[model samples]
Target: MNRLTIYTLFSLFLFTNCNENAAEKSLFSASKSPNTAQNIILLIGDGMGISQITAGMYASDSILNLERFKSIGLQKTDAANHLVTDSAAGATAFATGKKTNNGVVGMDAQLKSAKNIIEYVKEKGLAAGLVATSQIAHATPAAFFAHHPKRAKMENIAAQLLTTDVDLLIGGGQNHFEARKDNRNISKELAQKGYQVNSFMTKSLDKIEPNYKDNFLYFTAASLPLSVEQGRDYLPLATSFSIDFLKKHNSNGFFLMVESSQIDWGGHNNNSDYIIQEMLDFDKVIGRALDFAEADGNTLVIVTSDHETGGYSINYGSSRKKFKTGFTTDYHTAQMVPVFAYGPNEESFMGIYDNTDIFKKMMETFGIEK
Candidate 1:
């Protein structure tokens, strides 16, 4: 063949291949699924950083449920006024899509009441829930339903919880409901509001058959609950059971926020055993959640942390099933945390973003307009 003929043919070959590649890429992008999740399961492991997860994996000597997630991203967990965020501000960011000042919950930095995911869904006639190892009125879970300038005001948060229209609440802080100084029995009030309020004193969670017809309220403890080592094993079961009950509670589906609240407690204590056991417990809850998500096929499960706590680290001489752990502080550090997503719309959680983006993403996944 002539040189000009050969050059022209080579150029055409390269151009055709490039066009085909671009077309394939466009097709793949167009083929991505839209918002399709009927149910959303958001799991927040408070104070659960990468090191905490690593320590759990090593100590448990098994794969974590988190390892199964294919879509993982990091979140910037900074408060509006501070680099290191408290649970209130961190969780507020996730609940309301706003970076509030530390100590704020369910409110923006301006101290204005913010509409949280639970409230947003509840108004849409969907079931909303809060499950935490800490008091339900504590910093993390309260952010979903209670707006307050100060998160430490548990009684105020407890009062606001009653107004939230949440379908289910499983955690501690029963006393905050009934033992208030205001002389109002919030538990009785909740019952008057047509809630089925029960407690650990009445019966254990496993034996209780949830009647899905009513708003379920089961307080696992009077105050802060025990660690898993001390027989606090209700998280996975409560999570599993709540999924079933909420699925029945609302035909429109549910938005359940499950918080492994004590992993952060362990970090605050700078106790390795506490951190390890809580991390493992949270992992089991993650497994249970994934189990439901896998079987149901329409549930989206997102696992993440509000912030990294204790500056936790796995140090030299660590071995499988045993860890030489180190901590730099007994409080949350300025560290971005990982977000693991599965099921429908999981692709939306693939890149690093602000903590507020989590709220936006969940809203989008629910197909919420604006």
Candidate 2:
């Protein structure tokens, strides 16, 4: 009775404990799986590489809102035809989940027009908005709403913007819309489309309270907006305002793309101070987005860059208070960029992937098929 009974009881005890542990593991995994987000806020810092973020962190006394993000990933920034990606292709990858040739916007390498995330969200009854420090018709922001083959076609891009169902548009480039060669005023056309079109020539953004009932468009400049160092202080404010306005405008949810567009320009100019200033400004915008996501609990905030510009690097002898920076070129380089994500489905973004995966991940996070 001793050996046989003891062996049988020990085997039974081991089987029961293993079954209980398996059940607990399954429950934990389900709880941590990606949950759908009500709102998705994508903040793109153009040409914001690791060096740019490091410089900004050092310049800002070693504190960055990016550090608050726990899920981070690296994205390969290559266009369909080139190793070094331009903003148009880079942004198109994020907006459309397609690898297009360099200089293409909202289209693939075969010149096929792709539906972007903004249009997809709008079709699903979610409001869409774009905020940028550059012209609204610029490559990055335009990719979200326009389908132009060439990024240089600002006039065409502006025209396409008038056709989209985007709820809010805040940036520069009023001339591309109103002062067109066709002698047509797109602002009036936007007004006809039920948008409250205002410009820097008429009213400042800080003074006017946006009405959520009507779509809003505020051109910050006639052409390209000024740099942050040139007293362009509206990025953070625009970010905060756009989030609130889009939230109020749409009952289901909203998709907003905010771009700190000038950081790439700084890299192109090989200006270290320019990069640092723009980087710091973009960090503030990220902080505002994080604050909203933290409070809303149903919002997903994804921060990343299209590609790395200027081949930027933080050199040796850099201190926590100062950054010794260097640049390899004046244009964008073939390098992978970093992606930081927070809120719902943030875990999906924590790995190495293609740039187009951003659009896929965001769409998945919103529970949108395809």
Candidate 3:
């Protein structure tokens, strides 16, 4: 055989062996593929730890929406300046693929701006949406769209929403927009910008149908929303509505974030019953996202948390009927959290990694340059 034929055969042999090797390590493989997801649905159960999930599973008669995921991984949760992480720092890692000091949002430790996945992907004509059980400008949800030096700058964060072209938003924080510290009425500004801004004060979430031609925003409460047990159960339906609206807004693709925001509050309160209620409600939201992802077949669904809170632990003698639990601290812990991925490129999440890698993997899955 000539040199050209010999080179071709050797390349083919190497390629086949590489595939065989990757197939052998399917569970932990990180090899890049040509396939890309048309949509990414990220579900964050804030402050949800293994013990919390266990308690919820038992409380729900030993069932959970998370059981549907096959690809699972662990992630180290720590801040740039401390061993333990707060929600803002932890969320910044996922939003910008970098660690920042606690309480900082969308900016780096040195206070430089970083383009979040939503902002970067929008350049490619992809629409985005956010759904949360907390205020829309709360740390976890706000990190996905707004940038600020501190997460507590709710008024400034609410004002920053006017700069983003995000398609849909469903959460609370009517006070931030309509009643602000700066005395600016952002909701009216949004209306002038052709956004259909509505809230619980005007109509219930179930009754407000978002108009696809205009951007949609719905506030569930005048401020922070109630807990799941207090008859606050709008998360699942809001997630479903967001997916539908974003899909219509951009047929090319979309990114959606659904947060069970109050799970962390339960941890802070050291209330097991509260955690269980929020956890169960979050699972329903997960089921809703999974249903959409499975039907679309082009969507990638990821479920994880920024950090574990309460250092929660399950006690012995616990049964599906009832359980005993304990907490090490009434605050966030320096523990590794679990990562679960489903749909296209799910295997990419099957190994232990840093929290920032999740952002990289999502960008990679969407074939977007980081």
Clashes of each: 0, 0, 0
Off by over 4 Å in 1: 1-33
**Candidate 2 TM-score, true structure as reference:** 0.90
lDDT of 2 by residue, 1-370 (tens): 7999999999999887677763364344335654778789999999999988888888886579999999999999999999999999999999999999998999999999998998889889999999999999999999999998899999988988667888999999999998999988888998999998888888889898777899999999999899988899999999999998887888788999999999999999999899999999999999999998876777899999999889888888888757677889999998889999998899999989999999999999988997
**Model 2, residue 289: C-alpha shift (Å):** 0.5
Candidate 3, 223-250: lDDT as tens digits: 9899988999899888888888898877
lDDT of 1 by residue, 42-141 (tens): 9999999999998888888678888999999999999999999999999999999999999999999999999898878877778988899999999999
Model 3 residue 39 CA deviation (Å) reads 0.3
Per-candidate TM equals 0.90, 0.90, 0.90
Whole-model lDDT for model 2 versus the true structure? 0.90
Give candidates' CA RMSD values in order.
Answer: 9.9, 8.8, 7.1
**Top-lDDT structure, candidate number:** 2
- Return whichever of 1 and 2 wins on lDDT: 2
Model 3 segments more than 4 A misplaced: 1-34
**Root mean square deviation (Cα) for candidate 2:** 8.8
In order, the Cα lDDT scores of the candidates are 0.89, 0.90, 0.87
Model 1 is weakest, by summed lDDT over 10 consecutive residues, at: 22-31
How close to the true structure is residue 283 of candidate 3, measured as C-alpha lDDT? 94
